[model samples]
Target: MTVETIGWNTAQRRGFGELIARSWSDAGLRLRYEREPAEVLAEYDIHLAAGTTAPALPPSPGELVVETFNAAEAVPPPPCMLSICFCLQPDVKR
Candidate 1:
C-alpha cells in the first residue's frame, strides 16, 4: 500500500524477479512474460499501470513501470523491475 520511486541494478532485478514469481504463485495468479527479466531490463522500459489488467508498454517514462490492479480487493504481483529499482536506491533503515 506504500509507493516509492526506485532505481535499477542487477541484484535488485533478480530479487524482484524472484519476488514476482513468489507473489504470483502465492496468489494463485499466473504471469505470462513478454520478455525474461534480464532481457527486459537490458532492453525495454518498465511500465506500471495503477488501474488496469492490460500490461502497459513503451513510450512511457522511467526504466519501467510496475503494473497492478487498482481494485482494493486485488493482490498485485510484485513489479517486474522492483529489484532493479531497489538497487538504485540507497539502503535506508525504515
Candidate 2:
C-alpha cells in the first residue's frame, strides 16, 4: 500500500473548502486544480507559507480521509490533514 498526505494549515481550511465546493460543479476548475493547485488556491486567497509545498492530488481516487483537530479549550488546534492510501500492484518480472 502506498500512502500520500496533504496538509492544510488552520487558516487555509476555509478557503480550501471553498475551492473544493466550487470544483464540485466546475469541471474546468477541477481539472485546473488537479494540474495547477497553487494557482487555483491563489484565486481563493489561500497561499502556502514559506517553504511549504502542496502535494499533487492522487492520480486517481481511492481511499481518502479528511481529519481536523479541535481542542477542548478555545485555543486553536492543529492544521487540517488529508490522508490518501492506495494499493499498488507489484511489478512482475517476466
Q: Give each model's clash number.
A: 12, 0
The parts of candidate 1 lying over 4 Å away from their true place are 1-5, 28-94
Give Cα-based local distance difference scores for all models: 0.36, 0.53
Output candidate 1 Cα RMSD: 16.9
Q: What is the lDDT of residue 54 in candidate 2?
A: 60
The TM-scores, one per candidate, come to: 0.24, 0.45
lDDT of 1 by residue, 1-94 (tens): 2112344455544544544443343332222244333333332233334442323221223344434444466477445544433222224321
When summed lDDT is taken over every stretch of 10 residues in candidate 1, the lowest stretch is: 52-61
In model 1, what is the error at residue 11, expressed in angstroms?
A: 0.4
lDDT score of residue 26 within candidate 1: 38
| Number of the top TM-score candidate | 2
Q: Compose the digit string of candidate 2's lDDT tens values, residues 1-94.
A: 1112345565566556545544544578789987877788787677665666764433433434433323465267544344422122225221
Superposed model 2: Cα runs more than 4 Å off: 1-10, 55-94
